[model samples]
Target: MNKPEAASIGLVKRARALAPLLAEEADEIERTRRLTPKVVSALIKNGLYKSLLPKNIGGFESPPMVFMEMLEEIAKADASTAWCVGQCSVVGMTAAYLDADVAHQVFGKPDDIAAWGAIAHAVQAVPGGYTITARWDFASGMRQANWLGAHVQVLEADGTTRMRPNGTPEIRTILFPASSATTHDMWNVIGLCGTGTDSYSVENLFIPDSHAALRDDFSALREKGPLYGITTYSMFGLGFGAVSLGVARATLDAAIDLARKKHSVGIAAMKDNSAVQGLIGRTEAKLRAARAYHFSTAANAWQEILNTGKLSEQGRAAIRLSATYTIHQSAEVVETAYHMAGATAVFKSNPFERRFRDMHTIAQQIQARDNHFEDVGKMILTNSVIPRGPTM
Candidate 1:
């Protein structure tokens, strides 16, 4: 393999090596409602923030598969850490669409930048830029992120919606210094709490035109690598799916360990029980099948992009389908393990308990929502293209 390929492989190993340390700090991370400074430092030291950034900007720009692999390994230790990493990595891809100098200035120091936010509301176009007045929620990694992005519908100076040729309101994601926005301490959640996915608000924040970029705008992209060819939303689906798979894997292993030692009043060890044995087998099969399907679909799309310099609509649809299916199946595997653990799974001290919560939370994310299935189905059945939105 070439140098880039070898470097990618090494990065995967590096991510795996961090798992033990992450697992050790999982409780602290959840309690703090954010990654500790030490954990954040570790991620920066390993260059994870630059995983998807262009190599020209001192980033790895690794293939999507490599990115997924690294996420899976990190998630195995703590889903929140993996989720934070996934969010930062995906946002880092925006650099490819930015002006060369601007991209360098904003993303040059990967260790100093971590961007996260939601797409909601609109920004009114002003003379030189836009005036932003919105509150974006679920801004994962916000606490540690030095930068934040807000996806907004562009409104004309007269407050009319700016329209594109496709009849959709033109939208752009505006980046700002994190200090410009006030964060609300509202990340209390049942799972993935360590992600620090709180609500943030900006009032009349003026961002220059150069600070915003049209998300997924192919024509505006400066880096023409195949990695940039994969739409941003599609990349999120893939990476989040990998995180679900990792969580399921870790939970299953915990169940197996419990079964080996725990004995009931009327039964021998749980491992010897035929029903428990069957549950484990079925869960393993489901997890493996889902993982295989997701990775295979991702690999095919990557290869197609490499060959054609772009991903076909069908390929994008397949990615949506596979990621949705993988996430749902992963939830099922986690549920099965949690159930089989019986009373043991209820205690917070047990690994199965937290993972169970994390799995369900993963299922609730936009990428894992069942609505994606319907979107993909409509595309396949009606021969329509996948609609460009969060569902993609």
Candidate 2:
């Protein structure tokens, strides 16, 4: 194996080593509605924050699969931590598109970079840069992030929309200091609450040209690595899918432990119960199959980019398909395990309860929507071009 591959394996081992500590702090994280400073420090100290960054900038620049594996290990301990890590890592990858000096200024220090937010605002062109006035919601990890990014539609100096050749308004992601934006405490949800995915807004925030990156403009990319060829959307699908998988695995383990010890009024013991036995067997199969499919598709896509310097549409579609399927299947496994655990699963004191909630929330994410299956199917069936959207 190559040196990078070996290094990635070591990183994954390190992530696994942190699982016990992350699990120990999961309750406190949930109570705070954000990752505890200690948890964040552990991730930073372990070099997980730079999993997707370019090597030139003191990042590991590990392959997508290695990044996903590390995320899975973290998620197995705490889904919220995994979700936040995934956001930070993927956002860090954007550094490769930035100018060297700007990248250094924003991401030079591992603790200084944390870009997590959506972009649905308008940016007006100014002399040296753009003026942004808008609000972005679901800014995960915002509480700990020193920097944040928002996607915006570029407007002309006169306040008219700037159109590209395709007649679509030019869109770019603008980066700014997190302190410059006003954050709203609005992340109350059923699960993954520790992500602190609140809403934040900036009024007339001036972002210099150096702080903006053209949205998915591969031609403008400064890094020629294979990881950069994988679209951010695809990475989200894979990373989030891995998170779901980890949650499912944790849920299954919890249920099995419960089964071995508990005996309901009717059943002699959960272990000896025929129905429980069958459910366990089936759920394991489903989870393993989904995991294999996801990793295989991701690895194949990564290989294609490495060999050819570009990923084909079919490869992208396969990745979308596998990720979507894995997430949904993982949810099913968790649900089945929760059901088998009976009353124990419904209690907050049990591991099954939180994991059950987290698994469902993961499915609710845009990346896990079932529509991706239809989109991939249409592309494969009709052999026509599929318009890129959030899921793809």
Which candidate should be chosen as best, given lDDT against the real structure? Answer: 1
Please report, in order, the local distance difference test score of every candidate based on alpha carbons. Answer: 0.88, 0.86
- The TM-scores, one per candidate, come to 0.95, 0.95
Model 2 lDDT at residue 174: 85
lDDT of 2 by residue, 1-392 (tens): 88766876777998999998998999999999999989999988888888888877878888888988999999999999999989888998888789988888888896866765775878889999998778889888888899999878988988799887888888787889999999999988999989999999888789999998987678779888888988787888899999999999999989889989997677589899898889899999999988888887888888788998877777778878888989999999999899888887898878988898888998999988889988987886896653332332
lDDT of 1 by residue, 354-376 (tens): 89999899999888877878878
Candidate 2, residue 224: CA error in Å? 1.2
Off by over 4 Å in 2: 384-392
| Cα shift from native, residue 391, model 2 (Å) | 26
Q: Candidate 1 versus the native: TM-score?
A: 0.95
The residue pairs in collision within model 2 are 119-151
Q: Show the lowest summed lDDT stretch of 10 residues, model 1.
A: 383-392
